[model samples]
Target: MKNSIAFSRRSLLALTAGVLLTGCEQNTFVPPPPRVVEVAHPVQKTFTRYLETTGNLAPINTVDLVARVQGFLQSINYKDGAFVKQGASLFTIEPQTYELQLEQARAAEAGGQATLKQAQLDFQRQATLVQKDDVAQSTLDVSTATRDNAQASRRQAELNAKIAEINYGYTNVAAPFDGIVSNHLVSVGELVGVGSPTQLATIVALDPIYVNFNVNEQDVLRIRDVMRRRGMTADDLNQVPVEVGLQTDIGYPHKGKLDYVSPSLNQSTGTLAARGVFSNPDHALLPGFYVRVRVPFDKQDALLVPDVALGSDQAGRYVLVVNNDNLVEQRKVAAGPREGDLRVIESGLSPDDRVITAGLLRAIPGQKVDPQLRKIDVSE
Candidate 1:
């Protein structure tokens, strides 16, 4: 019985020792987290000097065709959406009424002319009679007055005929300028009246189109500096080079020039209105199309860091950078204007330093990490 008790104690002690050792081994086996490092190699990229703004494309010219006279729509000469030229026939009002009015006026004018011719003969005869004392002065005077009355009547008739002719010309509705027409609003034989109150259609000029954009006050200052550096005056702005861009289904494809800059800034919006002109021989740029503007400026090289590596703290903005010893560090950085995916590093970092790009959520300041150093291409 004594030997059995001793053996049981030994077995319990051995099991207790094994448990303690296992706990110790586990305590030493803590896993390390992944680390990301920023690369410092010079990269080649076209840092486009650009300004982002919302803008809309507009036709160089837009006009609404409205009725000017009372008449039935005799014909719609131009099809809806058809390209039209200046003075092109668009609508024909029933001109039969106007034509008849014109004929009546012409007849009256002819009658007045005949009367004037007879009065002139009578005046000549009266003048001869008065000069030769062949007739009484009072009779000659009466004849002269009659001749003047006839002349006045002839002038009135001529003025009436011209008014009728103008009304008759209004029957043929012609385009004021070259442009594409919109849908027809009225059908043939519809009672369209003077001041064809309803628009026949809308026409927009597409070639050398205008792209309207607004410039912020700050950008205006920058542009002014640029202009001064180029020795440009107000008169020079009309000829200044302007570049325009638009994003299409196939990507940003269309190109144009900056042709117009508004003389005054929009007070309500606090922006300067500007325009860009582009060729639309194919009529691709329709008025009211949405597009982006790309305004290029002088190229500059600046210190930058990827946006992913940056973080905000109570002390402002900072980055987790892996210093020379490959250890995690908290760097308080001053950031400046953003350049695409990277931001200009105003201070607290150098071109030779590497900043941590990822693994930030898993990291804390002063923590030791198993660094998976991936080289970042800062040039992109």
Candidate 2:
């Protein structure tokens, strides 16, 4: 009876230990819930197709102000970097000397006029006397020759006077156009235009500025194809609108039109040179600035997603999408130009796919995710 009781106690103890181990295993091995992520359908809308490029700002006109006549620099009419109007006098180069030369020229012109009048009277008299046979042919010929010489001298004097007047006008240098003038290179009282033309200053037009860019051969062909389909003439090409923005700008705030397009592509760079003109009344855009440029081609319906949702790796750009089974999968995408805060997906994503826009780190590939549906803000 003692042996039976001992055997029953050991059996009960082993059964109690097994029950405890089963309970612990059931509680400890419970799997965690799926990671939660925000998912959204790519925004569908009519999007403008743009050929995006980087370009440089340039002045529409840049001219060097130089002394055309020899004289001392008498005055600098504009301050350094001052905006001036067209035909405004900007410099005076020894006006006193030029003024005296102009006076001498005028006197010479007056003398020439008097001599020409006398020659005309003498020629008339000589011709009348010869017609009446009152003077010998030789005498008339001598008078005619004298009158001709006087006429030639008068013509020479008139030309010299005109040249002198032109030189006098050059003493006062004027702005060729409305532009901002650079600092004077030569100081006051310095002799200029002695040997070669002296550079006085530089003026750059700022209102209508140029943005220069290059389009690859492929893009050029694409643009031409669109033009051909639309039956657009060369003149219509200039009417195409262009938009630009500075590097720090959020978007293209400046508007312009296509000013020029090269007729031929560059053999070495495989690019076509193009330029646009923008009206910058505030003088905000400056020359030599690297800016973002875009030309709208046409509008079409396209799928767009938040730019922040896109990710990249060695394989290129991609986005994460949750499958119908709530499993995360990476979709490689071909991205187009950015519109506002969204990026145009050229391909590789279906309209019905649920793209993970948030909790990207937790949503691993091939793992289940509890996706929370969200809507993309197209207004931005």
Per-candidate TM-scores read 0.68, 0.87
For this target, which candidate reaches the highest TM-score against the unseen true structure? 2
Q: Model 1, 224-292: lDDT tens per residue?
A: 887788777877665544554456544246676667788888889899988778888998777788887
lDDT by residue (123-214, candidate 2, tens digit) is: 88988999999988888788788788888888888888888889989999999999999999999999999999999999999999999999
lDDT of each: 0.77, 0.92
Q: Which stretches of candidate 1 lie over 4 Å from their true place?
A: 1-48, 135-148, 194-196, 241-252, 297-380
Q: What's model 1's overall lDDT?
A: 0.77
Per-residue lDDT for 140 in model 2? 78
- Residue 246, candidate 2: how far off, in angstroms? 2.4
